[model samples]
Target: MSLLGDDSTESVAETVQETREVVQEEAPPKTGSTSFKLARLLFGGVLAFMAVDNFRNLEETVGYAESKGAPMAETTVPAITGSLLFGGLGIALWKLPRLAAGAVATFFVGITPVMHDFWTIDDEEQKQQQMIHFLKNLALLGGALAFLRVGEDD
Candidate 1:
């Protein structure tokens, strides 16, 4: 009766069962320790704050993009997308710690250089400001990774 062949029905059932088992195996523990809870809260809070701050300054960010010769519309879209992605990852951190941390780390690596290109600036003060922002993001990325590592053992 199956379109594929006589073997298709059994293969489909096996795949479904395997998926269910994988899902069950990956489910988070019912009770998390205090340290794990604190880590999640801190990591999520930082991400949420950064997302909001970036979104609030979208106009300035777009202007910076324009200075770099990027189209305003294209630059604005990524800014908005990053804001939403960060905010969502912040929420996900509490529920899926490891995945959230990895996502945030990847995002930080992608955006840091673009956001703070100190090499492109000649003024010392502006260079320092860019370096500071770059370092801050690195610190946050480290924190997220640490939190995820600790959460994994819980």
Candidate 2:
């Protein structure tokens, strides 16, 4: 059965051709966006900067992750931060957008709740600070999710 029409004998090639034509006809022309490009650059820059900062203080970051009860903190911290560095740069350069978005989204999802569990904090000030970090991660996750949609229209 062909998805392009009711014809049961339609070949895959024909269906693909028809679908391609339809998509080509329906897709809108792409628009240039200086603002979007700038945003990508900034978003990527921040991630890269944070990764570098964490690397510069690798022992401190590892210790902090250990304090948070993270297993294999010694190995995990550098890997995660390294991913952030590459993901950020990839996104900023638009070199590997889908991979970059995945990398970023993965980082946020993996670390945010673990690192910023405000519900687990008893001190009011610390809880507030963790909550702020949690919220910031949520926003960054949203941005990464948006980046995942970049090539969808194509």
Candidate 3:
């Protein structure tokens, strides 16, 4: 009765194929390469775990930050660590990836030098440790910057 092809097996199969093509066209591109995804997962998980560790040792963390001349160490440390917590989760889960990257980038930018001022340290052993921490933060920052390119509106 219809002008279009009948609801025969072939017609149904053709319709399915057309629908699949449309879906393929409309679907979002892949988020990241497999290697990058795995890296992101580990990076985010480590940041989150670090935040938890910081919180678990809040007093010691606050004291350390205070020793580094961090203003409002008690409040600032917790607030900054929160960015790590949520940002890490978002980065790992691919939720709000841009904002999450921003949060992570903020941490590395804001705290890396202040907390691990290797150049300012006189003690070789302490300076070496701090330098390692600083470089680690820089590497993590590089990863966060890469994640900023991820196609995500949230």
lDDT of 1 by residue, 1-154 (tens): 8798879988998999999999888956543667656656666776766676666776776677667655464665466447536634653456565566666777677667777788898999999999998899889777766755755755
Model 3 C-alpha lDDT per residue in residues 1-154, reported as the tens digit of each score: 5556466767888899999999888845456669767877898999999999999999999999999999999999999999999889888888888999889999999999999999999999999999999999999999888787663522
Residue 78 lDDT (model 2) = 97
> Where is the poorest 10-residue window by lDDT in model 3?
145-154
Q: For model 3, what is the C-alpha lDDT against the true structure?
A: 0.88
Selected candidate, larger TM-score, 1 vs 3 = 3
Judged by whole-model lDDT over C-alpha atoms, candidate 1 comes out at 0.68
State each model's C-alpha RMSD to the native: 10.1, 6.1, 11.2
For each candidate, the alpha-carbon lDDT, in order, equals: 0.68, 0.87, 0.88
The top-ranked prediction according to lDDT is 3
- Number of backbone-clashing residue pairs for each candidate, in the order shown: 0, 0, 1
Best by TM-score: 2
